[model samples]
Target: MRAAEHRRELVTLAYPVYAELLSGVTAGIINMVWVARLGGHAVAAVAVATNVENLLLGVIFVAGSGTTVLVARARGAGDRAATHSAVRGGWALWAVITPVVAVGGYLCREPLARLLLGGGEGGSLRLATGYFAIALPGIAVLFATNVVDGILKGMGDTRTPMRLAAVANGSILVLDPLLILGCGLGVRGAAIATVLGRSAALACGLVVLHRGRASRRPAEAAECGIGSLGADARRTARTGLPMSADFVVRMAGALALVAVVARIGVDEVAAYGIATKAMYVATMAFYSVRQAAAIHTAHLLGAGHDQRRAVGRQALLLSGALGLSALLILLTAAPWIMRAFGSQGEVAEAGALYLRCLGPYLVLLACFIALGGVFEGSGASPALARVTLCGTTLQLALAYGLSGWGLPGICLAMASSMALQCAAVGRMYLRTGRMGRTERPPATGSEADRPWIPAAAASDETH
Candidate 1:
């Protein structure tokens, strides 16, 4: 498709995907309100435990994304063998990562919670641990389900995932309170409910991926098929590491907020929470579109086409559109949304102010997201990680140094860091024709196994 045609296609493909994001966030918002009704500790426990879980899951996502990039483009190139290779690799990836995390999470739940809740006397740590313990094992099911979903999406099948997401969200919304206070399970019950909901969603997503999406023929997906385990593992590891690192950068970046925003008090914290919810609703949709572009770019490059420029342009345009919409929502409807989560009036007001302050943030973040996709699609997962780390590190430094000024200063720090990150990644893409480390350098004795990094090709031609 031409650039303009591609853009329109992207918008169409993204609508249902975007709805998935919106509904998912809506479910979370409802869950939060219900949990909040149980009192501050219950609410706080959910927040803290969820953050830790996100951090762990983010790490896992790095591997998952690698699986998506590898599988999507292979499928796009019309190579049935390579397509299934990527899928198998993704499953293997979860097999490796999930168990380690579950066991570690259950073991370290106390210390992790203490660190997250800051050893407060309010029983926040215990509550967080209770939540984490209940949620840990269920994570395995979540990971497996998502791997199948990601593989399907890599092939341009988003409708099934969205449908699954709706069911998942509905289940969570209904189950969150019922299991928590209803079963006298307390905060642990809420966590249990989320896991169950996720499992249900996973089941739905898996069915669609295996049955509704890929070719029903067993022979087509030979590349990612079960037998090519060695090849899949090698490629997935090389790519997944950097992607996971990017996740690390994000989690670390979020921690910077604790130092910067903590001084503004719990109300400010709650407000930021709500604002973040809104931000995710807007940005995740944009991200879904970006993922589609990544798949497109990978396929094009794999076909020896110079469509990278077009991919870059479309990604930026969509990101900009989504970011602007987020800003508008934040500025106009912050107060209205803030009214629902009323632990304190001041907190709600502060959150409303936060929504306004962070409005322009979406623009800066758009640059970061699109660039990262460019990097990932081009087989430069490590480069994307480096870029993210650069910006996140800057945020941490400024957050600590500027905390004396207040929460708004932290917001400024975040914005500045984003701008710098975008500039850095964009420059790298323009000059290198791929992000740094476009793909992992081949391991010794495995020169034939090298990933398809475009910049490496351009360089070889020059020599």
Candidate 2:
């Protein structure tokens, strides 16, 4: 594709994803708002519960992200069998994974709450367990919705997922106050509202899955003769494991960094938490760019196009612009942003300082994340995952060592790690260029092992 075409496609694919991600964050914020009214214990409970949910999300990414790339590639190849196989694999993996997290989580809710709360005082622990009682079991809805969104996005239908997110989160916004305070259920009420909203949205999503454009394709009519459930689940797991690892590793690093910051003082830890949430607005845009690049890259590769260089360049450009924009906003608006979040005193001061120091990290992180999508789409995610793991380790080590400098030091650690990650990825990109016209092989062995040749050649081979 030409540069202009590539730019346009990236923008088209990215905005809706940004909206979808934003809606999720917005839903959490809304939940927090309602829960906040219940007292510090209630807020703490919801926060811990939400963090657990975020971890659970990483677990589901195995299916959600795997299905997306596989389906996109197959769709581009116009391979009906491969497309069907990809979908089946995603569902298979989901079927196996959901019950484990949901049921197991419910069974372990109290211990889990204690662990997250660090065996804290009474009210918060009980409240957190209360939330988890419903939320853990309701994770099935969250897991299923993610798979549905992934499938739609893989089929190049980002808008529908965006709409579904709006529907789901919007329902939460409406239900939170009514359920939490009006119904007098408190923390459990918040959990119930969240589950009901997500369940309704999941139902709508399933309807779309059955009757929407992606599901109605002529390719859907073709028999894929996909293998047994176990085989398909394994295939999906293999494709998605690196992506899931990358996410979980990063989350683990963030959580660990919080502990590092905690050594500084309660003020710094509080500041870090609030600042991170504020930063999600900017970071989510970067991730959306990454997702778009991945989808676009996978589609083009499956269609026998080797345009990784162009795709990488465009992704960097888009995400870089976003990063720079975020930098400028944070630099100029740090104090105001902290104030907007209702922070004050040392917490406000520390948060503002952190925001100002966050610019370099955000820019480097955006570039690395966007380029990593190219690797992911082309099945090089293991390499990217390794990079992430190393970077995260470096970040935590640096954060602990630099705790003397407070939140700014933590920000410096983040920037330093991201810079290393960017350098490594840059070297890989240049190496690919030096390797010349040879296609970077797909990351896995299934049908993707088939070499990409001309459409005519592929058809001839099939015949």
- TM-score list, all predictions: 0.86, 0.93
Give lDDT tens digits, candidate 2, residues 1-463. Answer: 6776787899999999999999999888899999999999999899999999998899999999988988888778777667767787888888899999999999999999999888966999999998999999999999999999989999999999999988888898889999999999999989998999999889999988778556545464444444455666776787788899999999888888888999999998889989999999999999999899989988887787767778888899999999999999999999999999999998999999999999999999999999988887877788889999999999999988888988888889899989999999888876643321212223334644344442323232111
* lDDT of candidate 1 over 107-146, digit per residue (tens): 9888888887767656777788888787887778767766
**Best candidate, lDDT:** 2
Instruction: Name the TM-score of candidate 2.
Output: 0.93
Candidate 2 deviant stretches above 4 angstroms? 216-222, 433-463
Clash counts for the predictions, in order: 6, 0
lDDT of 1: 0.70
Task: List candidate 1 segments past 4 Å from native.
Answer: 120-126, 215-228, 264-270, 340-349, 432-448, 451-463
lDDT of each: 0.70, 0.85
> What C-alpha RMSD separates each model from the true structure?
4.2, 4.0
Residue pairs with clashing backbones, model 2: none
